[model samples]
Target: MNGNRFGRLFQVTTYGESHGEAMGVTVSGCPAGLELSEEDIQRELDRRKPGQSMITTSRGEPDEVVINSGLQDGYTTGTPIGMVIQNKDARSGKYEPYVTAPRPSHGDFTYSAKFGTRNWGGGGRSSARETVNWVAAGAIAGKILDQHGIQVKAHVNQIGDIEAPPVSFEEMLEHTEENEVRCAHPPTAEKMRERIDQYQQEGDSIGGSIYFEARGVPRGLGAPRFDSFPARLGQAMFSIPATTSVEYGLGKEAREWTGKDRNEDWEFDAEGDPIPEGNKHGGLQGGITTGQPIYGEATWHAPTSIPKQQKTVDWETGEEKEIQVVGRHDPVLPPRAVPVVEAMLSLTILDFMLLGGRINPDRLDGTAGEYDTEYHPSSPDNE
Candidate 1:
């Protein structure tokens, strides 16, 4: 319960259960006076909402975001922004049987052990449905990063051993949303789609990884050790449900690399600023930003709530049973995780930017009541 909040200067706290009436997020420390509207948040939510494709869940939640507070004249009030998305399609009846016979490889048993009880509906608080709040808060964070010319994009790069070739950041933005699988590479996306359909038909799930990148992030946004940029990013990625591993530039592949090959040589850019000749470090040196693009991958395990018959034991009766977790569930995760990854990237980078004093914490421009500037939301009357 206490761990629901994330970030420091730009904090976000989420509430509501998966089968509850609504899922909501409260974001604090967003500097006042930037253009904001439900539309801005809704656009991002639409990407993460269920029933997006054959590969995603068929749940019918619209995921429409309602901004209930923290705005004045379509601009941030510099107060906590409160937003909620109602749960319209949750069916908790199928989960009733699992109340005592916790599903295999799920949080049901662990949550019950920890809290003595749980919502037990559609996996309740343990559901990936909780990420709706993350996408909402991340939408706000995306808006903040946009004001600073920072860009974050992600794509489904690997799906069950089908990997796409490397793509540029621009390519990711351009092609990620063009397909159901959200892979920047077209052929790979099609194959991934086919692979997902196979799993869905088999009444099972597949695992995959998302490749994310942040461009135009300034240097010196992280600290050494505990507060390293990658550390925060890893924490963010791991927070997503079912995530198995996180890796940065070169990542685990660097293990087989020699020191001479792994180390990036320094070079002077056209602007006469120092930069690494190659970005194998993933834009980090000594746990701090290096004024280069930060790129990485986060892998997710196969979703646990599949329809395949699995064995479980009822805690109360001490009886073993074969149960099939039949319900609306995704065949794969990375397709829908693209936006979530980008949102977390934006949130983490914006938090670092605020913490590093690169962006003003009180306001976008560091001045109060200045609405005529570029960062200010434009008025329809003016148009």
Candidate 2:
């Protein structure tokens, strides 16, 4: 219903609904002759699709991607790239009872209040299914970034009170994909899965934090003043469903430190290059990349749909009623959100690269070159 598009030079406009025949995205401004295939996009979609593991929703959709347009002979055509994934396994009937009863912690109440009516089937446009298009478009973005050796990865950092031990970005990329929970630490992933299974059995849900890292981003890739890189990245990330909060670098914890503790002191290397002693700034200083690994976290709320009955008012009767949402949902959203967060990061960095003139927009397949500066992450003093 409007505001489906994102980005300036490299743009994506998503369409379709949760219970619709299918959902898709049309990506424009992608340069011609980039190697792209259905498998490229489908691999990422499979990660975001439901029924991956016991912790995820049971809805079984293949999430097969169909490249309907903009590619010729297995490469991009510099026009709009259209891709769709059918919703063969959607259980729209389960939502019939909630048409008039708004589920708590969901967009239903706000949407109905603004639109006067709604599709009332599978949460309509507000469903997490809308993120499928983002994953598809992000796959292309990943391809573009890969040419420059830039990598974006995310993992479940915390579920409830179970926080995993800190690991390097390289270790995360190596091990996070090993488990369905997407936690790099094997022990923590096991506990997270066990906790999620326990909650699902009780007809409830849980929420957690997801950590994201982008490596090899060239410095000077963000706009200064109002359109800062962190600001733009936050905007893109917050657009995802259930993303309640986002913080880069040390995030809210930075507030607890004094100037002496918070400031990331810079030193000169043997060659007189600036070396940061800490990442208290999260690789961005004054809204631009410092050529260091960018780290951030996003928090998600527990899914609103649950087998546990929730109290609500019947719109027609103006009387209270009890409702139990029966449709499938992720007991913990952070696992599914991993790919979504990475996609937003890709979109943000790619957009900033375009805005800052670091990458050529017209020549999408061209390289962004390299930053002269090198970043070495010293042990964080405050951590």
Candidate 3:
């Protein structure tokens, strides 16, 4: 519970359980005077809400976020912004069976081992349900990013065996969210949807990958070592439930390159700014942003809440048993996980931006790093 917080300057501490009365997040370290509203947070929750498609959970969370405090006159006061979303549709009874029989590939066993108790309903804090809190905080960070001309977007590039055709950043933005799966290619999305439907019929689940891109990001946002940009991004994405792998730029493909291929050449853009010709380094070099579009990919495995019985040990009896988890869950993760990828990126980047003294709350309009000249006299970034 202590580690619930994410970020150093732009901190977010999430609270509540999957079946708890209300889930929420408290955002701290956001600069004062940014325009904010519950609607801003609600819009994000809507995208992350359950039951958007047949491929997703049918449970209607309605996930309507209510601003509890920290805003007056439609602007953030720079205090802790607290928001909550009530769980009106959760059916705790359905998860009762999972209490004694922990499901495989889930946090039930580990959580109990760590806390000496666990919320059997909906995997408690271990549930991806907790991601809603992240999306809420990310929405605020996104509002800040917007003023800075930074845009964070994600796409379901692959679902199960269906892979979207290669797409450019512009193409993904233009058409990624046009479909439920959030894929850039329409044909690939259709096939992906059909695959999810097929899995639903089989009472099973599948897994796939998502790609996140952050555009217009200011250079030098990452801290050196320890909290490196890619390291921070990796930790954030890997925290999501069922996210098994994470890679940036060429990722694993970097291993196939020779010394010549590994070396990148910098070319001047229209503004005469440096841009990497070959971004096998993924818009980052020396653990910091390199003024190029930052791209990352994460692979999530199948949901454990499947109809098929799986072998597991009973926590209470220590006896082996089969558990056919009964509950509504996504047929695949990428469709719903798209927002989460964006959320983590927004939160992590904003935190780093804050630490690097990039945010200028007073300016209301301008890119993040544009305010560096207006830094506090006592601040190190000013010298």
Candidate 4:
């Protein structure tokens, strides 16, 4: 709970539970006079909301965001931005059986052991639903980045064992939105969809990797030594539910390559600026952005709420029993995770930019027309 707050300059603290009456976030340190509306937050929420497709959960919550504070007319007031999304479709009845029988792969048992009490209803705060607040905060952070020409995009790169071919950020932006799986490769998306369908039918689930790329990121946006750019990005990425692993650039593959192959060679550009032919370092050298795209990948495990019966011990009886998971769940998590990953990237970059003195704090006037309109919400790849 202490770690719920994130960022240095532009900070956010999220509250509420997965099956509670409502979930919300309090955003502080925002500059005044930025163009913001319910639609701005809703657009991102729609993407993060469950029941969007067959591959995601069937929970019918509308996930509509209500801005209770932080704005007057159509812009931020620089105060704590409070927003809430009500839990309209939660089925607590499905969770009655799990009150004592904690589900595996979930935080139920561990949370109970740590806190001495647990909200057995729909995994409580541990559910992926907790990420809705993050998606909302990320949307605001994204708006801040957009004002400064920074763009973050993510796509499902691998589903289980099926890996999509390497694609550029622009190509991914164009093609990822074309399919439900959100992968740039049409063929791989089809295969992944088929596999997800098979798993859903068998009452099981699958996991995969997502690739995120940050474009138009300025240099010198991260601290040197401790809080490196990639290190901060990885920390935020792992904050998401089910995120098991994270890596930047060549990631673990660098272990197989010699220093010459793994290290990026810097050369002088036409303007005498440093540029690298290959991004083997993932755009960050010495824990700072190198005026190149910052790229990273995250791997998530399958959701634990599969219908397949799993063994669990009944705490009251002190005997083993099989649990048939109920309630809506995702057959695969990568597709839905694309936006979540992008949000984290946006938050991290914006935080670093603010910390690095790249973003002008005076520019936050909360008036839509006051800020410069240099960047639009169009695909970053096209730019």
Candidate 5:
């Protein structure tokens, strides 16, 4: 419960359970005068909300976020922004069967082992449902980034065994939201949607990877060692449930690649200004931004609480049994998790931006301008 906070300068502390009265976040360190509205946050929530498509969970929670505090006249007030979304659709009755029967690949057993008890009602804090908090906070953080032309986006690159062919990030942005699977490739989206539909009928789930990218980040936003941009990004990303793999800048495959193949030199643009010729470094060099497009991929395992009969031990009777988990769950995760990944990235990037003094903080005393340096992506030298 004490570890619910993320970030140091631009902090976000979330509260509420999976089946609790409501889920919400307290966004601290956001500067005043930023135009923040409920609708702005709601737009991101709709992308993350359930029942949007047949491939995702069937549970229909409006996920309507209400800004409880820190706003006046649709603008931030330099206070802790409190936002909450009521969970009117939580059907806690369906989880009675899992009271003592922990599902595989879920946080059930590990949570119980660590806390001496677990909220079997929708996996409690371990549920991906909690990711909505991050999305909301990310919306705010992204708003800050938007002022500087920094943007984050993600798309489903694979589903189960099907992988999307090479697609341009521009094309991905243009077409990612056009499909229900949130993929850029139309042919691949159809295949992924079909695969997820098949899994849904079989009462199972599927997992896949998402390629994420962030553009317009300025250089030198992270510390050298522990607070490295990638390190902080990893901490924020793995917080989501079932994230099995996270690879950046060649990731684990770099071990098999030679320096000649992996190394990419900074090329001068037509303007005689330096620009990244390639993304072999994923826009990051030694845990810091390089003013190029930041790209990476995160893979999530299949949902754990599937309806298919699975073998588990009933702690109540200490007997082995097969039980079909009953609850609202997604057949495929990566499709819906695309926004979640981008949201976490946004939060991480914004936090680093604040930490590195790239942006000014909110001051109640009307003293706010604290320019750190002239390091900007759009600096005349880079432009």
Candidate 6:
């Protein structure tokens, strides 16, 4: 409940439940005078909305976004931006059985233990549907970062045991959206799709990882130890429902190598700036960015919700039961999670950028007492 808010300077507080009437977010600390529209946020929401493709859920929510505050004539006013997306497809009947039985591997039991009671419909605040708010807030952060040439992108790199070959950032941007799996490799995406279909047909689910990258991020945007870039990034990724592990740079593979093999030596770019000979460090050095592309992977466990019959104890009756979690659910998560990953990345980097003084926190143009921003509305008297 207390943790619904995220960020320090650039903050977002999300509200509403999975089966609630609507989901919404309030974003504060964004600089004033940036051009933002409902369409900008809606575009990102569309990517993560339910029922998008065969691999996704069958729910038919359109995920339409409406910006209700914090703008004037299409420009941000440096105040809190409020946006809402209504839940039009919620069906609670199927979820009723699990209200007392507690779904396996889900937050149901824990939520009840903590709150003494829960919404129990569509998993309430714990459902992945809550991520819709994150995608919306990230869209605004993406717009803020866009003005500074910072680009964030992500792709499904692995589904179950089918791992995609490493891809370039350009490939991720160009080919990620081409397939239902959202993998950059076309042939691999086909394989992933087929694999997902196999699981869907079996009434089961699978897990996977997402490879995310941020380009044009400045160095020294993070502090050592606690407030480090990777630390914050890890928190953001792990907060997503079902995320099991997160790793940066060489990640878990580095454990097999000696220090010499893992260490990245320093070199100079054409501009004479210090750079790394290799990016094994994943664009981060000692918790601060190295002015190189920050890249990593976040792994999600198989979704807990499955039609396959699962066993659990009925807390109220003290009896055991087998239940089929039949409802609209995704067989695999990474495809729809792609935008959520990007949104968190954008939000994290933009917050750091503002904290590092790389961008003006008061105005997008970095100039105080000036209404001359490119996004500012102009009078038609001259026309």
User: Global lDDT of each model?
Assistant: 0.88, 0.84, 0.84, 0.84, 0.85, 0.90
Can you give the TM-score per candidate against the true fold?
Answer: 0.95, 0.93, 0.92, 0.93, 0.92, 0.95
Clashing pairs in 2: none
User: CA RMSD for every model?
Assistant: 6.0, 6.7, 3.7, 6.2, 5.3, 6.2
Candidate 6, residues 1-383, lDDT tens digits: the string is: 57888887788999989889999999988888999899999999988988888889999999999999999999999999999999998998889998889999999999999989999899999999999999999999998888889999999999999999999999999999998899999999999999999999999999999999999998888989978999999899999998999998889998898999888788889999988898888899989999999999999989889988778999999999988889899998999999999999999998788777787778876675533212211433111
In candidate 2 the C-alpha lDDT for residue 68 amounts to 94
1-383, model 3: which lDDT tens digit per residue?
A: 56788776677889999888989899977787889988898888888999998888998889989987888899888788898889888788987766777788888778888888888888888889999999999999999988889999889999887888778888888998799989988899999889988998999999999988999888887757876899999889989989999999888888898979799888998899887787778889989998788997999999888989789877688898877877888889888888888999999888777767677543344445444323243654222
In candidate 1, stretches whose alpha carbon ends up further than 4 angstroms from where it belongs are: 366-383
Better of 4 and 6 by TM-score: 6
Clashing pairs in 6: none
Please estimate how well model 6 matches the true structure, expressed as its whole-model Cα lDDT: 0.90
TM-score of 1: 0.95
Tens-digit per-residue lDDT, 1-383, candidate 2: 66888876678889988899999999976767689999999889988999998888888989999999998898888789999889998778988777777777778878999989887789999998999999999999999889878999999999988899988888898989999899989899999889988898899988899989999898777757767889888998899888889999989998898999888778875668796877888889988888888999999888878889788887877889888887777898999889988888998787666656666655555556653222122523101
lDDT, candidate 5, 73-188, per-residue tens: 98899899999999988888988777787777677778888888877788788888998999999999988888878988899999999999978879888999999999999999
RMSD of 4: 6.2
What candidate 4 gets wrong by more than 4 Å, as runs, is: 365-383
Where does model 3 exceed 4 Å of error?
271-274, 361-383
RMSD of 5: 5.3
The positional error of residue 78 in candidate 2, measured at the CA in angstroms, is 1.0
Candidate 1 residues 138-173, lDDT tens each? 998998888788999999889998999999888988
For candidate 4, write residues 1-383 as lDDT tens digits: 45778776667789888889999998876777888998999999999899999888889999999999989888888788999999999888998887878887788789988888977788898888888998999999999989888888989999888899898888887998899999998999999899889888988998999988989998777767767887788789999989999999889898899987776667987789878877888888888898888897999998778988799887777988888987888888888888889888888888777666566544564333333313222633112
Ten contiguous residues minimizing lDDT sum, candidate 3:
374-383
